[model samples]
Target: MDQTTTARAKGSRKPLWTKDFLITALANLLLFFSFQMLIPTIPIHLSQLGGNNVQVGLVIGIFTISSLLTRPFAGRALDILGRKHVLLVGLTICALTIAGYTYIAAVTLILAARFVHGIGWGLSTTSLGTVIADIIPPERRGEGMGYYGLSNTFAMAIGPLTGLWIMQSYGFSYVLLISTILAILSICSSLFIAYPKPIPPTNRAKSQRFTDRLWERSALLPSSLLLCTAICYGGIVTFITLFGHEAGIPNVGFFFFCNASMVLLVRPITGVLFDRKGPEWVLLPGAAFTITGLLLLSYANSNLSLAIAALCYGVGFGSIQPALQAWTISRAAPDRRGAANGTFFSANDLGIGLGAMVLGAIANWSGSYALMYRFSSTLIIVFLLIYGWSIWSYSLHKKAAH
Candidate 1:
């Protein structure tokens, strides 16, 4: 009956799941599931088409670059246009492009399809992120985002394994067929969601310079941190299959399975921690786990070692990503959530693009995936320094203000 008890009761009653939220989350799961299916297998398909390591990297890089370019416009549109309109358009593009992959026998054609697919990826994901942010009560944003992220986690768990199995048993074209089907299902599920209405731009927002409208300044810090982590992720997803072959391991898909399992275990707990404490509670430890995971991956030569590495990386990745997203959305103005999500994902695309190119070149030059992984892990050191410096500077500013 007292104020503290009353507040706690009300907080506990805040809804995190609703009909629209569930539908959107299901759509996002299918979208990611379709995409994740291609992440590991695409490189192999490209190689079969006579592409080398650098070319494979280029394909991945180009996809992310295209996605990166599309996101700013998509974000602006999500704010000015309605979420449902942008989402459906994006999903339609994705389904079509994924089907196109079935006919791409040449490496050049695959690259072209990937580029187009990335654009759809940018629009749909940005719209989904913004939609979920809008639907979740701010009081439970961290927890809500965590649950939403599980859709991605679940997709990661099975997508690659299923893709690899299909490619081995049926053919690469079958993978494309199934991925296209999943994407179409995503579109169908997305249609059922009751989307939030667009927020009209403020007078100042309308008057802002063109470049200024593309990014949310409040989201930049977390986005930057995310970019550093994503650089390492880019290398892993793109090359892990090849690396497993090089090491004479029979299956690489188990890495994704174990990784997703750990992610599934840690995400909800980390989300609650992030909500109750702060991002620091999760981020610092997450970075350490990621670093350790990459190092383990660098040395891995067998299934057990790979599984260990995957578990560590998954815990770190699952913890850090949702925390950063929640932090970004919580800081941004409600009207600017679309732009904030755009900026956040743009960083992700940029990092992945850069990582693919740079690490691919490294792998090519060194003739060793292990060496490339070692190099990739160092990027997290940069993440930590930036995060630590920000915290230190904030404390200094707080003291000076006092």
Candidate 2:
């Protein structure tokens, strides 16, 4: 090949993995690991502190509410203040608040701490996602996002189990200490990641002076769809363990182990399919898988049945998440990507918060987590139909343009 042709080939070859990406992913994993450890422990801690179900729910609920409230501002901060600044601030706050848990016993104090922690979570996660979007090559976006998302997947797999073991073996104080230490480690790792300079906003330059900046219109559609999927996912996270206990399953941790394992195994393939064949090829079948998993979970009686459900849900979630993120990224202008990611995550957290309340109520009303899963399955089917309609409409629009 000629010298120019060889150079072109090298330039066009997108690097799916990079040093910055790896550092960011590792930092993200540590951050999530620290957060996830607190998830199960917090409720137990609150109960031990003489809190009832209502108080426990309020303490848990406030965190997401705070995060959702913070995300829009965090998005704007990423664009205006730059990524590294916001990220470091977030990690510091997260670490400090977690450490604060060691000193607090009052439910009110705990609620305050939780809100601060959620703010930290919001800022850090939004900045992290924007940083990845800034660095990842456009051609390799789906593949890159898949690998990045695996960090969170791994955290989900291992964090709760480790936290529960630590808390059970030692005490809640030890869990707090360990989580705080991990948060510090996450900050240290984040320091090594080099973020690119922010792109100056062009379209919104005039409006920035006067208008509110909470939502990114470009990110709305995909984010909305993500909200739907996350509602069902949140239900799974909130009740799956309890559901297992109620159903007479002894080793419920195996379900999460299976779920995360499938996600890890299938993500690379789904990413490739997303890049090569577009999201329609992945998303339609992914929705089917998710619905099927929910159905299986609803009926599961044995370990084998639960494993199958986890496998299906894992594959479906692994496929759909990166594809939706890639789609959201594609819709935004370069300068607006930070807001895009913020909107995306905000919708996600909202769904989780809503699902916890709504689906929990359903479980309580029906007196069965299994029935709640059945309800969640129906929601997924509705989401699929909506997603399908959007794809169809977009296709028609493209044809009309042609």
Candidate 3:
């Protein structure tokens, strides 16, 4: 083949191993590792740093606030910039942010680190999700996403357990350093991935128009019955860590491990279910399991109780997340998949972030973890009632139109 022909041929050839997928997965694994590593330990860490319950909430809450604030801009920037470049920048920022935590002796400095970490997280996660959507075929997107989510599940599963082990033998700074190293390694892995060139805007500023569409969809999400399922699911996942801490639970690691295990186990099964049966059927049971899991958590203070809660939570989270995503995906056309996901996840993120912030603050004000659980349970019920209204309204509208 001539030089141009040979180059084109090589460019068109698929890799034997799909190295891009692996690299992306490693990056995701690293992101979750640092992101989740402190989950079981951070409350204790803040307490050690002389922070009161409110400050404890502040440290955790600041991260979500910063992350949630950055989502729209992050999504837009990913569209404007190259995914690999953004991914690399995010990984480097993550490494520095995690390392910065080791220097924080005061709660304020710790909160600063968390806020910066949130920015890094926002950029990195947005790029990863969009990149996967860019690479995967529409027909198989759900399956591809299902497998991709396993990266987070596995990392979340391992991070807390490994973090605790390191803290037991080494120290907090050392564990922080380990998290930094994982982040840096993610940057290295990202370097191996080949991102396709940015799609030229056929209509200038189409991304902006897409963003506008997203905001409107978001307004509808909260009142949508199916969305209530997502909202309730979000709150529970965000605050469950606090639940473990209050019980003087020695093994927060084990608690999360059970959660991750269920997530790891359930994704494939749910992927097929979404593929065959569609999203609505899977979502209801998913919400049911999530509610059941949280209730079990409310009742259980021991490790065994915690483990059962995790099992219930794991199944609940695994099923609900994919079902919601697939539902959103099915509702949109291929051209707008990124926008659709941007809209869907923004709601999901808002639910979780707000859950952490508002509920964590409430937990602090109430002066008891048990009260927080009770509060969360009540919110879930409220979510269900709202969701039921949306469903009924839709049914009546369809009947009238027919």
Candidate 4:
């Protein structure tokens, strides 16, 4: 509309090409790398701490929950605090907490560290998504988002496996130290990105309180949709390694390997669809496939079932994330994009974190992993009900307006 608005939208309007964008993107990649590096080591650490399976699950779930709670505040803070500062603070915290793992022999301290680490994750992740959105054009959004998602995709594809290898070969402390060093490097690279100084109490002058403007009522369908996807995500991210252990296959790598393989196969197509069509086309069907995959996972007894479930879950999850991201982009006002990302992801973290907690409790109480799947599938039905209600209510409003 106006020149100022246009300039802000197109500011540094380049993706992966500019040092500003590249460094910003790479910062996220590195954060995820440092984060995932701890994944394999956690179970090992828990084993040494003499905790049971439930404790391990709680450790993982707390990370998500802590992250989840911070998102709304982070989103609002990003609008108030400025992206680079938030990113820097988050990265610094990540480095410290990651390194802290070496000295934390007590299980309580370890869990506390994870909880604090989540705050950093929420800040960093929300800022990264918002900053990248600032750089990429709407026209190539799907493609740009695809490439952007690659940061996590690559990390997901590689981090845990690599971490596991190093842990087995060197030791947990070395892996934590290596992750600490890389995190420090990420913080340094973050300083390279140029940001216009904020004038006042503004999230880089995008100042708005998240609670005041959250699409709490309007975004029910999309938010519910995101929740469903998150529940499935929780189960996989939280328990797949245990699943491997239970099945006597023990490939912690394959959990994400299968996820990455399918994401690689399907994300480009979903990205194109996201840019061309709207989210509805991508999301509703994606939910079905995700549900099917979880159901299949409930019954999985062999490698074939595992791979099949992964493929299905990957297709489902890979499709949902960008679509929801685009929807958040579409729904928010120009100034509130960061807050929107926060709300969407807060919901995401809540589902994953809380779902894992609930499911973990189920697994703990029942003394069976299969029960986790059954419960997860039951939650899928709850997601469907939420989705159906959301769509119906929106339709009624639309018809009334007409």
The clash number for model 3 is 1
- Score residue 183 of candidate 4 by CA lDDT: 91
Answer with 2 or 3, whichever has the higher lDDT. 2
Worst 10 residues of 1 by lDDT: 1-10
CA lDDT for candidate 4: 0.74
Winning model by TM-score? 2
Q: What tens-digit string does per-residue lDDT give for candidate 3 at 244-308? A: 67776666557667888888888878766655555545556766777787778767778898899
Quote model 2's TM-score.
0.93
lDDT of 2 by residue, 203-303 (tens): 75537642345567878888978888899988988898899988988887788899899999888888777766677777888888999999999998889
Model 1 Cα lDDT, one tens digit per residue, 190-213: 889888777778887888899889
Error (Å) of candidate 2 at residue 378 is 2.0
For every model shown, the clashing-pair count is 0, 0, 1, 3
| TM-score, candidate number 1 | 0.89
Report the alpha-carbon TM-score of model 3 versus the true structure. 0.78
lDDT of 4 by residue, 3-55 (tens): 22233355453343566768877888888898888877887788788988778
Minimum summed lDDT over a 10-residue window in model 2 is located at: 1-10
TM-score of 4: 0.84
lDDT agreement with native, every candidate = 0.88, 0.86, 0.68, 0.74
Residue 393, candidate 4: C-alpha displacement in angstroms:
4.2
